[model samples]
Target: MPLEFAPANADALPLHVIEQAGLDGWTESQPKSVVTWVRANNFTGSIGQVLLIPGADGAPVAALVGYGKPETRARKRFVLAAAAEKLPEGAWHVASGLPRDVAETEALGWLMTGYAFDRYKSQTPAKAGLVAPEGVDRTRVETLAAAEALIRDLVNTPAQDMGPDALQAAAEALAAEFGASCTAVVGDDLLTHNFPMIHAVGRAAVRAPRLIELRWGEAGPKLTLVGKGVCFDTGGLDIKPASGMLLMKKDMGGAANVLGLARMIMALGLRVQLRVLIPAVENAVAGNAFRPGDILTSRKGLTVEINNTDAEGRLVLADALALADEEAPDMVISMATLTGAARVAVGPDLAPFYTDDEGAAQALAEAAAGAADPVWRMPFHAPYEDLIEPGIADLDNAPGGGMAGSITAALFLRRFVAARYMHFDIFSWQQANAPGRSKGGFGQGPRALLAALPRILNL
Candidate 1:
């Protein structure tokens, strides 16, 4: 369901946020009866704690939400998300005095916490609504929240329903909604069209592999996005153990995030020639499955030795990246759930991005901070270029020793594109639930990218 934003209502319940230091003063300002009730209930201003003030009519008059001590930094953004989830059904608005940006962030968080994947199971929709916070772009916040919901929904879906063809359909639907042109090069045609690596990786699956492309915008700087869309990864000939394959359904998270970001760009009507390329495939095992040690020539004519079939995400992405590079767009962003090493380096909450563009990197870092989408910049580390170099082929899909798995994987993909690029290695699935973030497929850098684009492109 799309996020709901209600018109401002004077009768809406007031949501007052209180820090530990100001709790006493806040209680003192209320009626003596309310203050006695608050003290009786032991309503200390601890983060995520909620206390509802009662009216003489026995209905809720206002809500007191704890912002924790000023020193607690972890619960900064999305501070009111938990309250949004816990508050009684009604129209609400922040009544506390807060900086515009902080109010915007908290308002966005309230909308985000309402998201629940109810595709299969019926769910009671959230009845609570928020009046658009003053000084916040209500439409932009709703658009972003909707885009993120799309990402999470797509990622949380099981492989049976979210296969390669379904992914293509999702892209086509998004394109149609935005008046963008959408097309797909499917099946054995991938070979004829020169996406050999993509074809090889997906040949064994019942669903055909496809290159889904969508183009929008008539003018401005060209921005291209490429995502690895491995719908279900079985590790091909190098099959993963049961535990390893448990969450493989989330392999298409990169594609989901790309589409999410694409939706944001088009919805916001950004002045940029936008192109999205997703190499949709299912890396399954079968008699015809591509094996490790196989050498495949990419669309760019660079040969790759597949040291591990499990490294198939980068292979498909290489071809797509090469296609994105052919036009030499002003900037290219590639996102993929390509390596576990990245998760080890930064954990699931922080996406690790690689780029040589310092200015763009700084802009993304700043944007991430403001958007509550954390991204850590990892060096492209030119020295690791040799690690991806195999004696038999121009590049190795999987390097030996595994010291810098994520770095080497980025280096391998870097060869396919010549334009200024940023690659995000995202662990799309959240292992545990957090405020405003459910334990399912998540969009890592799309929000950060959206925030950074205007500044980076000078829009």
Candidate 2:
């Protein structure tokens, strides 16, 4: 369901404040009192604890929530989200001493707590909900958060239920609802259709790989989005360790994100011809899997050596991107859960993108700042292009040295892209749990891109 953030009602929830520890004597005393009260009652905050005490009137007032071990916490980034998770169904105000910005960010984060992937499961009474905080752009926050939730849900599902055929089904369903046109080229037909690199990568998987395309809008500037949709990466013939292969289901996070972005764009009626391309594949192992040292041609007609079948994402993307590049749209952006190197560079929360367009970079920077969705821009270094050089072919899928792996990956992809483009290397899973972030699959980077779109496209 689309997320809805209603404007915070002022009259209904009149007085509230958010307070940090060590702020003042009352603030310091309140936390101690709350803790003491919890101990005396033999209640634990581990399962989440909340207590309501008498206020100025005879009626009960705002409650105190115990968020365990503030010192060990990494910034209490989503503590307010806990409130949404556990609070009873009702409207409430922030009544302590949180800074306006922090309070607002947390307010939006709280709404995320309501998400549940019950597609295959039955609903429980513990289902959560919340009203948007007062004086905030409820519509915008709901739109963005709901879009992100959609991305996370799609990525979290196991590959058996989310294979290339299923991915195409999803695209068709989404397109039908949004009045967009959807088309796909599947299986061996990929070769007949000139998506050679994509075909080579997924020929091994039982589920036929496909290039799912959706186009929406007209009478406006063009924006093309490409997503790496490796439904499950078994590292191809060069298999990964069991640990490395554990979460391969999330390999298609980029595909999920662009679909989520498509949802938002169509819902908002953005002023652009939005084209989404997703090359969905399962990088499984088999004799037919393209082997290392094999030369494969790309949609752009560039031959690449399979230096490592593990580098299959860029290969499939190369074909899809070459197709998108054919139009030289005003903006071409691609998202991928592509590299571990990116995680080392910027961690999971901050996605790293490469682009030579200064205006686009600055616009994204400013948009992220305003939206509180942060991102960092890496470079499309021409000098590093040599790293992708192959001894036997025009380019190598995986370079021997790990130095600048993410940047080199971007550079490799750059070889196939003819127009100005940006590539996002996202670590699409959350390592540790937080209020709104659960323990398993999660969305990354797309929210920042959504926030940046209006500014980048001058909407």
Candidate 3:
């Protein structure tokens, strides 16, 4: 469903957001009849609770949504999203009470709650159009929400419909929409182009592997993004258990997220010479599949011993990062659903990012707070560098011990790029539903990056 904004003249119902502490003062402002009705209905201000204020006509004239108290951290972010989900179908506008920033967040939340992955399903979600609150940029909110929806759609799709070829198609479509130039070096061309690691990991799949590149903007500080696009990870020879393979389709979530961020950058016309690289592939089982013991040469000329074939995301990303680093862009951001260790450490809600730059880390933290996108900084611990080294090769694809899996993976990819880089180990799938996010594919790191780009690129 499209993210809807109410017209100025539209008869939008008023949405009053009240904190539990202010409930008494709020009731004083309400009509006696309405206040009595609310009391009779046992309406105490609770987070995510909603009360419909009735007019003389016996229809809801306004909505009173509880934001809990000021100390309620969970409601502090996207409090009004619950109202969006429960509100009767029609246009609604926030009533005056909220802080400007809070209102803006509420507006974005409303749009986010409208997202539904109905590609194969026939049931359309109920419409709850919201008017852009005062001081909120409607265009920016819509662009972000749409980009997130794009990410969700791409990751939610099954492997049969979201293979390597399909991923390229999605990238090309996004490029076309933004008037950006896009190209793909597919099949054996990956080898000819010196993306041998990418080629080696993906050569066994029926759908050939490819590097999808997109370029946008004419003049500005160069910003490059690299995403691992393993469409379906059967784990190659080190195949995952049946349970482990269930969500394999989301292995390409990194690619989807980068595309989503690319869409936002181009759509918002950010002043940056943006370049996106996605090594789209499927790590499938075949006679020619890359083996755990195989040592493959990367685009950067580093040899990696495949300690585990399941660790294919970093292989593809390494080659792409190398290609990205040749230009020596001001900054390169690489994202991937790389390791289960990340999930174990930070859980599914928070994206764990690694970078050596202190200023960039601070900016990311601030941006994450501002955008309501959660990210935790994981160290690029110099001590853990030894863990990635195997005696036989320049690096081990999978480290010896199970410890610091995310950090070791980051260290492996760090070998390829010379530019200031940040690596995000993200769990793209949401295991449970939340206010604005559903229990499906979700975008991580992009929103935080988007918020930080202005300062990071000095744009």
lDDT of each: 0.89, 0.77, 0.89
Residue runs of model 3 more than 4 Å from their true location after superposition: 75-77
Please report how far candidate 1 places residue 388 from its true position, in Å: 1.0
Report the lDDT of model 1 for residue 326. Answer: 94
lDDT of 2: 0.77
Q: In model 3, how many backbone clashes occur?
A: 0
Ten-residue stretch with the least lDDT total in model 1: 1-10
Candidate 1 residue-wise lDDT, 1-459, digit = tens: 358677765468888888878888887777889899888888888878888998989899888888787577464558777667778887887788445767777777888878888989977545567888778898899999989999998999999999999999999999999999999999999989999999999999999999999999999999999998999999998899999999999999999999999999999999999999999999999999998888999999999998999999999999999999999899999999999999889888899999998899999999999888999999888988888889899999998896899999999898988899999999988787676777789889999999999877778
Predictions ranked by TM-score, top down?
Answer: 3, 1, 2
Q: Residue 265 of candidate 1: its Cα lDDT?
A: 98
What is the per-residue lDDT of model 3 for residues 234-340, given as tens digits with 9 covering 90 to 100? 99999999999999999999999999999999999998999999999999899999998899988888889998999999999999999999998999999999999
Per-residue lDDT over 1-459 for candidate 2, one digit per residue giving the tens place of the 0 to 100 score? 234543345323322332333223334456565456435755443214555554456454555454444563344456667655665554556555335565556666777666666767853322334455546666667776778777877887899899999888888988999899999999889888999888888899999999999999986878999999999999988999999998899999889889988988887778899999999999988888889889998878788988899989999998989999999888899999999899999888887888988988987887666455667999888898888997778898899877899999999988878787889898778776667776656666666677777777777
The window of 10 residues in a row where model 3 has the poorest summed lDDT is: 69-78
Model 1, TM vs. native: 0.98
Backbone clash pairs for candidate 3 read none
Model 2: residues >4 Å from true position, as ranges?
1-3, 6-15, 21-51, 54-60, 64-76, 94-104, 120-128
Badly placed stretches (over 4 Å) of model 1 are 75-77
